[model samples]
Target: MIDPIVMIVTMLIVGQIAVSVPILFAKANKSALNLPLAIFLVAIGALALNPIIASMAPNWYALYTALAFPALFMLCPSLWFYVEGLTADTKWQLQKKQAWHFILVAPALIISVMILMLPKETHTAIFIDDTEVSGWFVSLILVSMLIMMLLWLSQCVYTLIKIVRRLSHYRKRLKDLFSNNENKELKWINWLLFIAVCTWIISLITVFSSSLLDQFLFNGTTEALFSLILIWSLIHFGMQQQPALVTDEISPKVKNELIETLDNNKNEQSKASKTALPTKKYQRSALSKEQSKRIADKINTVMQSEHLYLDASLSLHKLAQHLDISPNYISQTLNQTLTTNFFDFVNQWRIEAAKPKILANEATILDIALDVGFNARSSFYKAFKQVTGQTPSDFRKAHQT
Candidate 1:
């Protein structure tokens, strides 16, 4: 009888392959994300399939095992690249500098090849029967496997840390750039990383434990289930993810100039902190304090008169175009002078606009929320409570009584 664990692992491999093929071949889905994502899915599938093949068909397992280490090494880096592709401010392309990420794969591949070159009887004795084999070649293979496992674990730790930091910076940049960050937040990625860390911890514990504990904790069923969940979540959320920085509306030259100015200002600020200068944010900005005040006033006047905040799709770039200023400068003005981010600055106006309507009590709260620039009622409720210290319904009750 086929083991249930074997069935589960088989299903995971099949499911990943099913998802990966369409993504790899679909022309419409071509982007920086697709290639790494496809590779990641396939690599995971390969890794999951390795043990099943070893038990069911030992003869073919030699070649299959040769490829398995490289697959294992590819997993974390591929996931990291996918995150990089998702949150990149510009179109992400694989660069030569990123080649180092795959360096471990070479040594892993070489060791796998050495193992493959060993005699078939040796493979059966060492892998299938789990017999102790003492020779220079066998010792080399065992030592290499141990080193690879350690390196892979370290790589997982390092890459996960990098991914978390990247997500933090990406979210911060989103606040500076977009007013409505509803779908673009990529919060699921955080959950995915958490699950991955948990799975890694379990596997680490299994590795250090006795054989009986290892059998219980590191069984095929548990690993396959975790892989299934991770792959499904990754595919579902990743397919819908759009580039965080939408560059289609803004020209490349203008975007580059704005980015350069922001970088220069940051560098100046960092240098100033070393010398114990007035540690004000944006202290090196070309916009003077008077100009910042003027810009802030301009923003308020425009919001009040034009009701630009009423546009649910309002963004720093769009606001900059309306004000005839750089987006970075507008962001700088909001942060330094107004002491708020673009998101909060705009949403506060939306909440204020929503108040009189709420007090009038003539329309449904959802209706008022939609009419006043919030895309969804939940966001409206959140912002309203945040800004006014009362829910819309509570505010109405308080005022009406």
Candidate 2:
């Protein structure tokens, strides 16, 4: 029988690796936060730590200096990848320099190990650990890990902050481009990064704090952190693999873009609009271009006139009645020409409209969301994110910048 604790930890590591494979193989949105690469590196690095430790064999204590030394460098790759993915609106790219972030730090990492291997007589003792390991050496390793961890955490925090700053800009752009006000806080963008930060902080607290420990504290902290890693794996790793899409909330413009893109004669994929492939099937419609446009124009008028999007219950059926068109026609026109369904198309405008209101800072996100026609803050939030890509709090942060 497998030891539950060890097996669980092993599975957590495996899940992290498995989660990103689909994203790497499937058609993923180019502008996405590169979950595949980040998770891949993190999974490998996390798993590699133990093996590297095992390699320290025979030398035993000497292995900490050798194997544990390079672990710091290993850790940096996943973090940098995640941050770059989060911050960039376009698909992420690693600059040549970025490609070498780990490499550049390697020399220091090796030096730290060598310092750890130095005779205790060579340096003053700081704290006593088992064996004759000098305080200076252990302190150096601990300090290095602490510094790197802080650096990683800081970058992750700053990237999300930058994304939040773009919220106001999204509002201004959407208002002029599409006159709707439903999305307030771009939910996806904020929530994912927010969760990432929270999870990372928890990991940091667990992992780094373990460095200060001796045998007793190390055992408890490692187990606790491993437990957290297990829990986090169940959640975040699962999410990364599936890449939950707010398809219903996606705007017609984006959907239209996708449809047009898929049908286009271009042999090579254009980087024009970052998009993932659509595996979901859609039916072909009999509606003509002229008929679809006419229908859309009428709906647009009603949308602006009654501000229908603010009504959270609004749907193609409800709006079709107002347009004096059949629901089939409404859906057909929306699918064929607009490239998105009625729900998302209208809600996109609503979210766009909600941006400015969120910016006013007078209304809370929940209040502004309702004022704009959302039934619940979560729905408003989901739509807002599906369309614009920021959260209400971040949206507020963007305009202030």
Candidate 3:
């Protein structure tokens, strides 16, 4: 009788390959994430095929093992690259520095080659018969597997920490760069990470447990189920996620200037922290208090006169363009003078505009939300409550009564 677990894993491998084809071939609205994501799925599917091949087709198992074991080293790095692609401010391409992430693969490849070159009886004793085999080669293979497993575990922990930090920085950057960040937050990735952590925990348990417990949970079924969930969620969310920064919208000169200014600011902050000196953000900024005040006034004049807050698509770059100022300066003025980010500053104006409309109660809440530069009612409600300390309906009821 065919084991149900083998059947499930087989289906999963097929599903992963099936989904990856469309992603790999997708040409419309191409993203840097596409190739990494496809590779990630295929790598995972290859890993999933390991046991099925071992048991069902023992002849091909050595070749499959040679390929799949090495692929374990690529899993976490592929995931890291995908997150990096998502959070990158510019076009993300693989950098030469990242090649080191796959260094562990070399040892796994060496061990796999040894397995292929091993004597037929020895290979059969180790992999097929599951009989006790003790020799220098056997010891070497066992030690290598143990070392690779530990390295893979360490890679998982490190990748998770890096991804968490990267997501934090990405969110902060979004606040600085955008007015309304509805779908760009990538919260789904957080849930995906949570699922991934849970899956890793299960794998750890399986790895360290006795043979009895391993039979029940470590037989690939539990991990396969979790993998299925994680991959499906990634596919669903990744396909819809647009690049965080729409670099094409800003001209190359402006984009280069903004990137340079931001990089310089980061370098300055790093130096300041190292020096243990108390320095205000943008302390090196040439925008003096006088200039800041002038800029602030100009900003208010333009906002009040032009009502730019009513445009849901307004962004820091767009505002900077309107005032014929650099985006870095606008960001600095907003942070240093106004004590708010571009997102909160614009949203506050939007909420203020929404207040009178809510009081008038002439239109539906959703209609009012759309009128005041909110693309969605949920966002409008959240902002309204944040500014007013009451929900829109509750505020309306209190004021009207």
Candidate 4:
């Protein structure tokens, strides 16, 4: 009979899997993180079902077990892919170069095939008595399992290191590109990576410390719990986040082109600034005071007249396009001329737009927050306090009476 705990876990896994797969593929689920996450849930669900299958069908258990090992190796790579999807500026897709990451699985696959090749009587005999297994075969299996665990541990460590480096670089670049880094920071992806690292650590420990049967059951139960937590958090945090329109670190060719353009602009600016005073108050950048004022004026005029901040999906690339300027140039102008960033610069206008509505008592605070492009009332409240030194409610209260 299947273990009672295993059976209960299996039911939970099945129900969640059934609900999750459809939602993952639904039309509303557009994030690149969705596919890898769906695959992760399916892999965990298959693992969860293993105990039930073994109890119900003894003859096919070896095959089931063999097929499942590859998915175990896939978890970290899926997570890495999800992070890449969030961080990469260009479209994220699995490429041929990344195939090398899976080379660590070849030994496990070969060993699994070897297990599958065993005669039915041999499989049954090995299941019943340890002494029936050949020493060489047992050694091969042990060595392969050891190698697989090492690969898992190494992959987890490598991924965590990459995530740290990538997030650091990403955030630094966001500071350059966006005034408000709150939405573009991709903090949820970091949480996912940290949780995955913990799960791998647990698996690594269970592998060495437990007997074969104990390892299977203990690892399965523990990993199932982890999987449930991961899936729940992944969906909850992930589904709400829209991928950034542009991330840091685009192609070298494009970066070089942007550098060339900026350099050209600077040469022209120097000639123009030759007669102008060197110490205008807002003229901190190498760009001429004239050009900085021109761009800043254009930015404000467009923002005031077009109300682009109301779009909620507005981004640096989109704003640059609206002004017919390069994104780098827009960022530089904002940083140097206004001493602000894109996120703050835009949301400042949003907060400005929201104030009149709040003072007029024309609508609910939540409705006004949503109308002014904030996705959440809490986010609006935070930005409002940051800008006005008062919450929306407090500001409204003081102004109304």
Please report, in order, the local distance difference test score of every candidate based on alpha carbons: 0.79, 0.52, 0.80, 0.69
Residue 102, candidate 1: alpha-carbon lDDT: 92
- lDDT of the structure predicted as candidate 1: 0.79
Deviation of model 2 at 113, angstroms: 5.9
* Root-mean-square deviation of candidate 3: 3.6
lDDT of 4 at 381: 88
* Cα displacement (Å) at residue 183, model 4: 8.2
Which TM-score value belongs to model 1?
Answer: 0.88
Instruction: Locate the minimum summed-lDDT window of 10 residues in model 4.
Output: 262-271
lDDT of 2 by residue, 1-401 (tens): 32345555655555655665565535335534454354444544454344334333324434344444455455435544543453332335556676555653566566556666666544223212334444665667657666765665565555456556555443332222222334333344455455555545665555556656522324333543454454455345434432211223445555443334223212222323213432222224455668878988887787778787776666544565577675556655555555664556877778877888888899788898778877778777777877768878876887896
Q: In terms of lDDT, which candidate is strongest?
A: 3
Query: CA shift at 262, candidate 4, in angstroms?
Result: 14
Clashes of 2: 17
User: 1-401 in candidate 4: lDDT tens per residue?
Assistant: 65576577677767777787678767325455677767766676666667777788787777886787777777767667766766664556667898877776687688789778776766666643334566677667757777887777788778778878867765655544443456778887777766766776676677656655454535566765775666667767765665553433555654543444333233223323534544232344456657877999999999999998898667666687678776666766775567666778888999999999999987998999889888778778889999999998899888875
Error of 4 at 290 (Å): 4.0
Clashes of each: 0, 17, 0, 3
Runs of candidate 3 with Cα error greater than 4 angstroms are 5-9, 18-32, 120-131, 207-220, 261-281, 397-400
